[model samples]
Target chain A: MKGNEVLAEAAMRAGCRFFFGYPITPQTELAAYMAKKLPTIGGTFLQAESEIAAINMVYGAAAAGARVMTSSSSPGVSLKGEGVSYMAGADCPGVIVNVQRGGPGLGGIQPSQSDYFQATRALGHGDFYMPVFAPSTVQEMADLIYDAFDLADEYRTPTMILADGMIGQMMEPVLLPPERDLSTLPAKPWATSGSRMERKHNVINSLYLSPNKLEDTNYERFERYEQIKEKHQRQELMSCDDAQIVVVAFGAASRIARTAVRDARKKGIKAGLLRPITLWPFPTKAIDELCDGGASSFLSVELNMGQMVQDVRLAVNGRASVDFYGRTGGVLPTPEEVLQAIEKVAAGEPVVQSAEPGAVGSLLPHPKHRKSSYERGE
Target chain B: MADYNHELLCVLSGFGGQGLLFAGKIMANCGLIDGRQVSWMPSYGPEMRGGTANCSVSLSDDAIGTPFITKPTALIAMNQPSVEKFAASVQPGGAIVIDTTLAMNGAEGVELADGVEVAAFKATEIAEAEGLKGLANIICLGKLWSLTNFCEREVADAAITKCVPPKRRHLLEPNLRAFQLGIDA
Candidate 1:
């Protein structure tokens, strides 16, 4: 199954009957799949006029207690930010999928992890936190999206599937989970589904007119966030027990880093991989354990300009040296390139760091395997 | 000779309109039918808009790490540009199947690595001659399979049967015929 289609099918199996999204590359297949499958399954699939409108529709559907979702790429995600924040403030449970592409603004239509900070630190202007699940493989795409809906409802907050274009576009064999019985799903008692003239009206709103009331709401949300941080931190540790150099990466970067770690081990370099499946929790305890387990250094690999390195640095907290390696503007760093970076770190040499615009030429090494512009006839 | 049981990293490349991605999908499906780990990834976005298109298909007995294959163990090049671009990237002792009907000078200018096997056939011409139009991709797939034996012939046939969509069932016989033609060649 293609990753995007897998997500859509998984969402339906999770009882997500409402989908509101605008078309955006890398992720358009997700919405297209929903548009095709939703109606046949007695569900609602609406392509709103714009991303903002789509996310607002998701908010409305979520408020009505429907298992709802919306998906988009980077710029479109930016447009949906306000609604996401609104959903968080109103305690609306919904799933938002960002099939990330290169971007500061319309950067490119290639796989990228530059949105790490955007998803974890600042999805929107808010004093709120949302659980972000990053899936590296197509099977994870199915499993994580299925879990995202349940997590959103459990926390009464928006949950995101922060995937890159590679996972969105790639195809792998998957065993999709069987469909959920809609009647067996937990009831949302707080839903504003008609009072039936039997009780007081249920209202869903983000605007608390009183300052203290709004502050109290924010405090309550933070308590849930703290609970999530404590109990929901997810990570995968490979060969960390005896590793000297631990490479920290997630999503597609983790897949590449895993191969590099294998190569490093073959060369007797004592390397390991730590993949954080949950970006928000940041898996600090995992890093602390590795640091205490005698790991010498940590390398953060990403498809961006060193966004997640800050989180890794904070987690390490000066316990070990943390280095950065990445490629931005939609370029992917191959396993061989990552292996080179690992070898440099192992040898105590300074690998290339993230470059600012116009200074990239000086900081970046020419990848040996990449085709030259003239060779590509560009 | 390449070990068919080992990890097989295959690249199928051609113009966007060609069936290169479909061929890669077929290969991945073969691996799936055989209960092997497989991943198929395409060079997406602008490349699908009348530009050079390619897909990487990886099959292995163990868990596949990355879907992107920078250095492939096998290659099927359907055009001159694809041959020029990817012919040298095939791993040593690996194999390549080139469609000479579209490759300029029939892969003569391309410099392959040491110990690499080359099977150059005019697949498009053969397909047209056999009245199976637009099946050079499958023909090359057949030749590549013949050289590497990446999967059993029965497995490949079953994969083709599974991959052909319900609407395109009419073309299955022609596609099967094209595969047999390449095997015979």
Candidate 2:
């Protein structure tokens, strides 16, 4: 099955009854699949007038205690930013899927990881962070969607599945998850469903007018976020025990990096791959431990203009050098290009340097760093 | 049987409406039925209609990496432009199969180096003669199967049966026959 189709089926099996989404390229198939299947299952699949309307609908369904979801591409996601922040503030549990395309404004409809900063750092308008899952394969895409909903309900927060156009459109055999019994679903006590003169009316809102109460809510949410980081920092470490160079990547880019790692290994280079399955948790501890285990350097390979490299740098903390290679606007970096970058780092050459402030490829020089035999080519 | 030790990456390319993606899907499904790992990624874009359409299929015993097949082990070109575009990208000793109905006459039309193995077949001609007009892509698949034996013939048949939608079940017999014709040819 295609990744998008698998995601929709997995969402159904995960008990997603309310799907409010607007059609967007690369992710339209997911919504279309839901439109066809959700009806037969007695679920609601709505195509809203706009992205903002779709996200707000998600908020409503989530507050009503239904497993709800919305999907969009990059530009569409930006339109839902305000509503997403509202969902976060209200502590609503739902899933948002961003099948990212190249973007700043109506960018080309091609796969990109440029939304890394938007998804992990500041998804909406707040100091809050959402747990973002980046799946490397279609199977992982289905598995993560199946897992995201439960995590959302457990934490009472929105979870985002950060997939790119490549992963969304790619086809691979996936094992569909077994359906959950809707009758056995856990009760949402905070839902705004009719109280019917019950014990007390549950008010689901983020609008705490008092400053102290809002501060308290913020503190409690941060506490839960910290716990999520500690317990759910998922990563895949490949050949890093004795590797001198570790390449960091996620999603489709990670799959390419893995191939490069294999190619490097065939050429007698001790290379490895570190794939961050959960981007918000950032998998910092995993990279730190690998560095402590004698990995000499780190290289971040991404499909954007190098966004994830900053997190890798913060994790490494100048203990070893970190470099980056990226291609923006949906241009996929070939494995040979990645292999070449790996070779440069293995040869102890400074392949990239911080050309400007806050740039992604910012390479801080170390006193112990060796000189490069080759200069940066253009 | 196909070699299970190494991976086989193949690209099937042609113009839109030529069933390139469908042929690739069937090959990937065959790999799955045989219990080999497989991935199929098509060239998705605005140009997908009336433009050069292609899909990469990888079959491997172990986990495969990078769904994009830059250096394919085999190339199935269903049109002249497809052969011209992808022939140079085949790895040394890799096979290049072109539909002689649209591509260069014989193997001399394409400009691949000598180390590459080239196979040319009148896929469209065979399909037309067999009264299976739109089954040219299936015919090409049969040639690919006969050459690489990536999966057992039974697996291909089963995949064909499985890939077609239930509404299109009536075309199964003719499709299989077209596939077999290319294999025998």
Candidate 3:
């Protein structure tokens, strides 16, 4: 199955009974796939009036403790931010899959990591936090969709499977979770399913008028956020130890960052890559661990100008000054450009990275091919 | 045969009738058949008309991130603009297969750089001359296999055969013939 199809399947496995989303570039297939498949599998799939209505529908469904989900590209996601805030304020447990497209506003439907700040910092109004998972490949996109559901329920907060246009668009070999394990999840205790005599009419709302009441609610949510950060600050460090340089990125950017490491190391630079699976709760601990002079300097790369670069800098905290490299306006930075940046970081030169290259290798692979040079240590 | 769960990234582009998207789906299905992580996203929105249309396909051992490629590791460019738009974006040391017949002005859009490996072939003309006007994608895929050695050749054949509409399955042999001809051409 396609990654989007797997997402639908994973949502089903997680007990999601409803999905509402408006079609947008790069993510329309996900909705189209769900629309056809959900009904047959006894689920609700709605092509809402707009992203607004879709997210609100998700909000309503999630309030009833139903496993619900909604997905959109960048612009559509921005429109749904208000609903995301409402979900967060109500402490609703649901998954919002942002198959991100490049954008400030109406950016072209190309894969980009521009939405990193938006996803990690919480895109909506007032102070709230939404955990965002940035998958580098299709398999993670599917599995994380399932995990997103569990995390949302565990914290009673909204979670986003923050994918870029690439993950949503690419095809990869991903295994389906065995059916048996998928059927073993626990029932939700908070769903408003026709409240029984033991429980009263439950209301899930963001509005708490009294300052004390609001503060109490916010504090409780904050406590949950703290617990989430402490427990689920997940990240994957690739070839980081005993390296002379480090490249940090998330989402599709992380993939290129790994490629850059291989290419750089081929040039005799001891470079490593650090891919943060979770964009929020920012993997500062793993990032700081590289400060043991494993790399004399660190290079922060992202599809955007330098949002996460700030986080990397903070993690390094002047222990070894960090460098920034990026591409904007929906353009992606290639590993070659990334390698150039790494060389600059290695040599203490100013940044001069560009998204231009001359040639490429053959596209088809041999039967006994290795997945990557790094894995093969070539 | 290639541990089907392995990730594959392919981008095919050309004029509308080139079957770029359909071919990408076939490749995607190869992974799906093996229960591998997969996604196929085709480029549209203004680029679908007479302009450039490309489909991004990725098959991997693990779940994939954005299916779109800002810098693809491998590509099959069948038009001038398609080549121009994506050449510079190719990952350094990545493979790019260009249909020389269609991409007449080679590297017009690409800046001079090291690392990216480029191979130009007469895929379109060869297919047409061989009476397979619709097999340009196959020819490109054949060249892709020759260059990267990324996927088993049999899987590509199997994927294409599986994706060809049933009513059109009668043409399956011609398609495979075209793929083989392109591979050895």
Candidate 4:
């Protein structure tokens, strides 16, 4: 199964009865698959007018306590940000998948990790956080879709999946998860299906008035985010315990990192990989564990110049020096290239001589120290 | 009997309808059914238009990296342009099954520098002959079985059977026979 199909299957298993999406490359097949499969299992699938409508439809169904989802590419995701902020303010729970393709515009429909900043940082708005899960494989797609729902509902926040077109279109054997028994799940308290006399009408609203009132609401959401960062940070570590080099990545980028690590190992350089499954609750703990005693050197690898690198530096917090490697404009670096970079760092050479920042695709610099636990990339 | 620890396949040129994508999917699923790690990826971007489409399907005993086949060990060509574009990229001594009915006319028609050429004419012919030309992709896949030693009969046969509709079960024998003809033709 491909990641998009796995995502659809995972949603069905999670009791998602509603999926609304518009057609876009890389992600179009996802919506098409859902259109076919959702109806077979007595679920509702809709092809909305635009990404705006699709995202808002997700918000509407999520308000009804249904496990709902919508998906789009990078540009479409940028359009859906308004709905995302509205969903966040409403405290609705659902999954939004961005099977990201290239660029700041319709750059290309090929796979890319450039959407990291858009997904992790607030894309649409005022102080808020939407948990982001990044899956690199078909099995991870199913696994993280389930995880996205659980965390979204538990925290009463929207959860986003930041995966690239490669992950979305690529096929792999996915270990289909056993269905979750929705019967065992407790009923949500704020669903608005017009309860009639059973209960009073529940309104799902994101509108807040007065500066202090909005601030309180924001604080409460942050409180939940803090809990999430503390408890919901997800990561994967490969051969890092006794490693001299640590390469950090997530989603499709992580899969490439794995190949580099293997090459590094073959060349006698102890290169390790740390992959974050959840980009929002950026797995700082794992990085800290790797860097604690100056035992591991760090390198942040992403498709974009350095979106995720900022998070890596934050995770290490000057406990260890950090370096960067990247490729952009829909071009992904091969594992051979990444391994070469790792070898250079291992040889005490600045593998990356300089990462030029442009007006459009500027290389993100190492940020200054900020007194915070983590920015939590989603 | 076809079996290997590593199998890499490239399927090219989309917009020829979904036939190529379907073929790659069957192979990938078959590899998985045979208990192997498999990766299948199709070409996107301008390659889907008035151009050739390419997809890579890989099967290995070990984990796979980069689903996109930068270089391939096995290939299946269903159209003339597909044959022309992908034939040159096949690994030396690797197997390439071409749909001769549409692609192979003469030695000048194929551009491959190396690899054994197995003319695959029966796929569309047999399917069209049997009034099921839509199964041409699978027929070619069956024919390629003789050329591909990575996946075994038991697994590929079962995968093909399961992937088809129950209503189409009556067409199974013809597909199986067409595949055999391609392998030996």
- In terms of DockQ, which candidate is strongest? 1
Over A247-293, each residue of candidate 3 has an lDDT whose tens digit, in order, gives 88888788778877887888988888888888777787887778874
Model 3, residue A302: C-alpha shift (Å) = 0.3
Best by the lDDT measure: 1
Candidate 1 residue spans exceeding 4 A from truth: A354-378
Model 3 clash tally? 55
DockQ (Cα-based) per candidate? Answer: 0.80, 0.77, 0.30, 0.66
lDDT of 3 by residue, B107-149 (tens): 6657834676677888889988989988888888777777776
> In angstroms, how far off is A373's CA in candidate 1?
23
Candidate 2 chain A weakest lDDT stretch, 10 residues: A353-362
- What is the lDDT for A210 in model 2? 98
Q: TM-score winner among the candidates? A: 1
> After superposition, which runs of candidate 3 have C-alpha atoms over 4 Å from their true positions?
A180-183, A292-296, A353-378, B1-11, B24-45, B55-136, B139-156, B165-174, B177-185
Q: What does candidate 2's lDDT look like per residue over A1-378, in tens digits? A: 888888899999999999999999989899999999999999999999999999999999999999999999999999988888999999999999999999889998888999999999887887688889999999998899988998899888999999999899989989888999998777899999879997599888878899999999999999999899989999999988898899999999998899889999999999999999999889999988988998888999998867998999999999888888767778787877788778889998755433222233524432223345454332
Clashing pairs in 2: none
Local distance difference test scores for all models: 0.90, 0.87, 0.78, 0.78
Displacement of the residue A194 alpha carbon in candidate 1, Å: 1.3
Tens digit of per-residue lDDT, candidate 4, span A211-320:
88888888999999999999988888898878878998887778888988998898888888888988988999988888774545788888887788889888888888
DockQ of 3: 0.30
Instruction: For all candidates in order, state the fraction of native interface contacts they contain.
Output: 0.82, 0.79, 0.48, 0.79
How much lDDT does candidate 4 score? 0.78
What is the per-residue lDDT of model 1 for residues A149-254, given as tens digits with 9 covering 90 to 100?
8889898989999999999999999989889999977788888888899988899999999999999999999999999999999999999889989999999999
- Please give the ranking of all candidate structures by lDDT, highest first, separated by commas: 1, 2, 4, 3
